[model samples]
Target: MAFTNNFSTSFHWWDRIFGTDTKYREYRARVKAAKKAMSKEQQLEFERKLMAQVEAEGIVAEAEAEKMSLLGGNKKSKV
Candidate 1:
């Protein structure tokens, strides 16, 4: 959720057929709002907890955690 994008790659079919994507999208919005309400330390703690939850659920790959910007774009290098 902190990664700022909504997707389930490793188990995409599970996410689509079972409909977890909708719930995950909603949860992401909540995550952003929650972080906005917390101090820096609290936000870090919250993200840690959130990361654990998502990792356990297998919603995305470990690579998603390292991304600070949205995936797939052409801001500086447009083709």
Candidate 2:
């Protein structure tokens, strides 16, 4: 029973590592195939959408940081 438990645990560890690598490769391949399948106009549209998403995330992050700084500075002043 102990040996079986140890074997199962080790198997899961290796499986997780290899499984993630396989999944990443599959994701990259799918993305490459989809990009190849797109026309120039479609590709440009996709890039524009991606950049918009990235910019939105950055703005959100900056706003969060500014809010946290304001809250932190206010607390220090009250103390």
Candidate 3:
């Protein structure tokens, strides 16, 4: 997955990755609302943490893909 600075576009990448972009957006809306009371700095920090999490998940996904390929025919398609 590509790392994007824009949250909307970033979620687009995630939607492709998880096949549930819409659901993720709904969840994000709830989370965003909960954090709406925070300062701009806090929001930025939250976004940064979320991006880091997405990055880690991407790495784990890539590693899993590699491992699965090693097993030959029983391949599961990656997002």
How many residue pairs clash in each candidate at the backbone level?
0, 0, 0
Q: What is residue 10's positional error in candidate 1, in angstroms?
A: 12
**TM-score for all models, in order of appearance:** 0.44, 0.46, 0.50
Q: Please list the C-alpha lDDT of all candidates, in the order they appear.
A: 0.63, 0.54, 0.62
Best by TM-score: 3
Candidate 3, residues 8-78, lDDT tens digits: the string is 56366755666646445554785588587888888888878876777786676657666767455467666
Best by lDDT: 1
TM-score preference between candidates 2 and 3, better one? 3
Cα lDDT for residue 67, candidate 1:
47
lDDT of 1 by residue, 18-42 (tens): 6657757666797899988999999
After superposition, candidate 1 runs with Cα above 4 Å error: 1-20, 59-79
Which tens-of-lDDT digit does each residue in 1-79 have in candidate 2? Answer: 1111122454666645556334334444755776898998987787677556656655665566666685642335555
Best-to-worst ranking by lDDT = 1, 3, 2
lDDT of 1: 0.63
